[model samples]
Target: MVGARFFNFILFFAGLAVAFNVKTIPLNADHYVKVLVLFWLFSTMYHHLRVLHKTGNTTVDYGISYSLSFGIFAGPLGLFIFETIYRFTVYFNKKRTGTDDPEEFSDTFYNIGAFVLTYSAAYYLYNLLRPVFELFPFGYWILIFLLVCITSLLIDLLLIIVFLLTSDIKTVREAVDFIKSRSILDMGKTAFTNGLLLLFLREGEWGALFALFFLNYLVSRSFYSKSQSIKNKIERDKFEQMAYTDFLTGANNRAFMDKRMAELDETGEYIGIVVADIDNFKHINDTYNHSVGDQVIRHFAKTLKSYINGNDNLFRSGGEEFTLFLRNRNYRQCLDLVERIRRGIEESAVEAEYGPGTASISYTSSFGLYFYRIHHKVSMEKGYIQADQLLLTSKQHGRNRITALDGSNKQGNMPVSIPKQKLVP
Candidate 1:
């Protein structure tokens, strides 16, 4: 919309200003080169406008292609015409690809296509017009044409892949960010190689070739900061995830719960802490083997997750032990939740066989429950100790039961026990 039109206008005016500043000779050959330059500029501007329409921004890809067009035309007029056709031909009837909106991919494709066409056209025009003035020796002409083809092909291949990969992205800003952060080194290497070829093989052109190589070096150097920045971001994210996650159960770990407790304390919110342990866990591993015990632990973790509130967190604190942090919940309601979890584990059968019914196994869990009070100012370590004391009580009295601590200030509260419920095999 307004943004697209604004960018298009900007590109057009900027190209025009550049075009007007080009050196012009009154002679026929000079005039023709100038025309080609104008064409190159216009075509490039048009293509960029198409890019803006699709991706909402212009990028380094577009800028590089524009620079190549400048090299091809050697004058503003040729550049304008080539760019203008590129804009119209590539974008006029382009369909959107899954990777990119129609406009962006089209603009990239057209930029590449336009370079091929304009370079071909400009070279041909130069040859035809130069014959009249006996300018541009055959050796020089052949070298330019050969170099143009090689450079265009290389740039096209690289840019085409980038376009295909990134078209689906929302904006040119994101696309460029991706390139800057991830792919710049590869591009710089390619540019360096190409520049090296021009410097070493093309006699008498070492100065220009060296300039291009230096430009490539500078471009490569520019990306070091961006690449390091992205690397830091990725590393930071990975560290954060590792800090909070249990690799075995894919559940929150103790560190994550501790952080949540800090938040709860700051808010002075009510929370229910439920500690659960697999009943006679040692016996199960001894009876069926450790592998089966592992399966039971995984199954228990998955089942427990289903019964939790949206805001609640489930943690695998240790072997056969888990903790749930339920926000804004009281002791009675937490007891009810614990009972339901117990019943669920008691009734559900886990197939010992990772496969069919023939190898199935069954397991059950006992829970220790405690609710946090707004008036309580205890640390997570102390809360966990209190819950562990209740768990020992459950194990000592009988397995497969729920034991809760009353909402009391007295530090050593006895376990509030439930009846032993037998689980069906």
Candidate 2:
């Protein structure tokens, strides 16, 4: 919100400054409008350049070339020329990308194009009226004004309908339907045409002032598109993050763990699988509030995450239990890793958002480590079972500690041989 407000302020101030500076440029309002329009084109180009430099997106270069070419040849046909090309490009790109319904392109292209056409027409209308005020008598101006509104509204409505109907509209057809359903397109056109009339009223000419409207719309439209795009991307990115993340613990969820494991397996990379569980979690839920119990679980998960290396994966499989996948590590190394994680959870504190604590309470966790030998001819399902068995052994012996296939305890760093038993056939 703060960012959006700041951007608005920046654009507003920048427009005023651009206007004040251009006022000195000694051209009729029409020519002055063109100058400022050029400014807008340059400003947009600069913005694209900044994006390209920051993100290393070669696509921005394409945009830069497009803008430059459009700016050079666009002239009085600026809105129509640019929009027609832009819509075509977006339509083609959507087709190439293989998206089922690229609805955003339709909404964006149509909405933006509608706005541009409206502004351009308004500019022309205002210019057309200038000769009227200079030549026409009293009641004639009123008639022209009313006639202009009606005519412009008709044209604006037709343009709006055309845009909504055409372009990459399949994805956004519903949105278009809804917009048209609510009569917003009609309302928007009326509002915009009226706004341009008011602009003419303010300055008594269509020249530089029309360009001001154009600048204002360009800035506003750019901001709106960027913000909406960012919001959508944020939603998609957040969902992607959440899809892989555990809801309760905010760790990687089971599905994500499986994905990582499969990748490691495919590459024949050695990984230690540690399955950790909170001690007496069920009792905690039964004794304290489930909410507090949830906090404890969350704390345990976070602590476990803190102990892992960058290459390691920590996932919550279900209630009170988590799975860890660490790459390029042996049984002993895995044991040490699990022990560190267990100790971290035992010692670390977690702030209770809805639980009892001065500030927060600490929780402990027990972990079971199993060496997953990629070299061994074992199925992934079998390896997971082996890891689970190690977890069961850890719980059976004691809680609040680490247990490995080597039988090494969390406190003692020494390795212990696994008791060979074919738990799963």
Spell out the clash pairs found in candidate 2: 29-207, 29-208, 30-207, 406-416
- C-alpha RMSD of each candidate structure in angstroms: 16.6, 16.6
TM-score of 1: 0.51
Provide the TM-score for each candidate, comma-separated.
0.51, 0.45
What lDDT does the true structure give each of the candidates? 0.59, 0.54
**Candidate 2: stretches off by over 4 Å:** 1-238, 349-362, 406-425
Q: For model 1, how does the per-residue alpha-carbon lDDT over 1-425 read when each residue is reduced to its tens digit?
A: 34443433544555555544554422366544544444344443333332121222334333233334244434444445445555555445343323344345434444434444444444345446545444546544344444445554544444434344555455667546544443443434434453343334224354554455456445544554566688799999999989899877788888887887777666665667788889878987887778778888888999999999788889988888999887666666777778888998988987765433434666677777776664456765567777877777777777788778765435855567785553211
| Weakest lDDT window of 10 consecutive positions for candidate 2 | 53-62
- Model 2 TM-score, 2 decimals: 0.45
Could you tell me how far off, in angstroms, the CA of residue 278 lies in candidate 1 after the best superposition?
Answer: 0.9
| Model number with the top TM-score | 1
